[model samples]
Target: MELVSKRAFLQMVSPLIQFKRFRGKINIQRPRLPHFEKAKYLAFTKPWFINPKKDKSQVELCKGFGEKLFEKDKENPFQEIIAQELRRWLTTSRLVVFYHHNPMNAEDEFKAYVMFKKQKMHFKKYGKRTLEMAVGGTPYETILDLYVSHNMTVFSPEPEIKKMLNITKKFPQLVLLAGILEGKLVSKNDLVKYSMIPSLQMAQAGLVQTINSVGSQLVSNLNSHQNTLVSHLSERAKQLEEDK
Candidate 1:
């Protein structure tokens, strides 16, 4: 039964469907101990000092130590860290170090990494759209949308890059060229040229590609089953097939 469930879990994380994790590293201050007490709150937990394999008895309500540390007073700690970490993540731009593995599944981790990585691109796209809305300017769906939609400007193509894009003659099926750098979105083809990557949606496509490249049959099955279950709930599949 457990194997079946784990198989299902893996399937849900399969790259074809593009599952992601939004994990955040947390390093808040631990509780201070009383002069009489032996040590800090960390000392209370057995795992930090003693048995590494077993889970330590969780700490209870004590303001930041509890409220800031764990979620719903449950055994899960990663989710709690995520909540706090996101609050300051964009602002700090700090690297989150992991002492141990996150408790969440691979899907959640994938989403988290994508979200963190593509955060800047999404933000810039949002900013452009927001500004465009004020002047009745066309807001692009993606950063590329701004250029492709308006033919805003022609990029200075590199000598090799121009030849590379010209390969559409040899590979007729080739559609687009994509490149990412420090959360920037860039695309160029035989016709149009480079610009920032635009939105979360675009990032989602890239995420999907990554997942499919690193294929996992189990994860695909899980995701497919979940999709089937969802589609059944809405009767969407039946209606779509009927329409066709």
Candidate 2:
């Protein structure tokens, strides 16, 4: 048996130990070859369909991911119902006033409601969508522009233009914009002028008086012609008798 020095033996054994450690430390496996079926399936599968119109970019870009997430439902049933009711009001109400108003606390709003109700008027607040749905494609659509920004509405069955103006005066926060009287859209200035005009009964009475005066004058003129003819005949008869 050949004798080896302790240091030389340790050096030789150390290399083998290091080689075993390296082998254990490093997992030398071949690069995985994907299963043929899986590879084919992956290669043939459709690429994800990204929705360009989607508002967010995330898992939704994957095909069939949350298909219903972006789907739009129909208009709210309540909105439709309210819109129908509004259309009825606009059509049936004799006075529909659109007023621009400042933001009011709940208490003030309640007070306003009570005040309006006292005069047999309705106070309503509607969203633009509701207004659009109600008046869209109708003749009243021309007044749609007046429905913007913090708007409140007053609906009265009577064409109480003057009364409405007076009521609005009590609420300093409310400024009238326009009104629909008897299905006609009247501007603010026109509304003031309309309020100043006489009532329907007064107007009818004046018209009747003028017509009567014209008729009386016509009768007087007609009688004047007949009276002149009679007078001329009487004169001719008198002259003939005198000549005889």
Best by lDDT: 2
Question: What lDDT score belongs to each candidate, Candidate 1 first?
Answer: 0.39, 0.87
- Counting clashing residue pairs in each candidate, in order, gives 19, 0
Expressed as tens digits, the lDDT of each residue in 1-244 for candidate 2 is 3565554565433443433554345445865567999889978995988767679556656546566766665779999999999999999999999989897788888888998898899999998878999989999888779877889999999988888888888788888898998888888999899899999899999999999999999999999999999999999999999999
Tell me which residue pairs clash in candidate 2. Answer: none
The true-versus-predicted C-alpha distance at residue 184 of model 1, in Å, is 3.8
Candidate 1 residues lying further than 4 Å off, grouped into runs, are 1-159, 180-183, 189-244
lDDT (10s digit) by residue, model 1, range 1-244: 9888877754444456755656644345764445655556546764735654365444422455765656544443554444343333323322111111214455654554444333321111112223233223222224333423211111211222333334323333223344322333444432234223334667899999888866886688779988988979789777888899
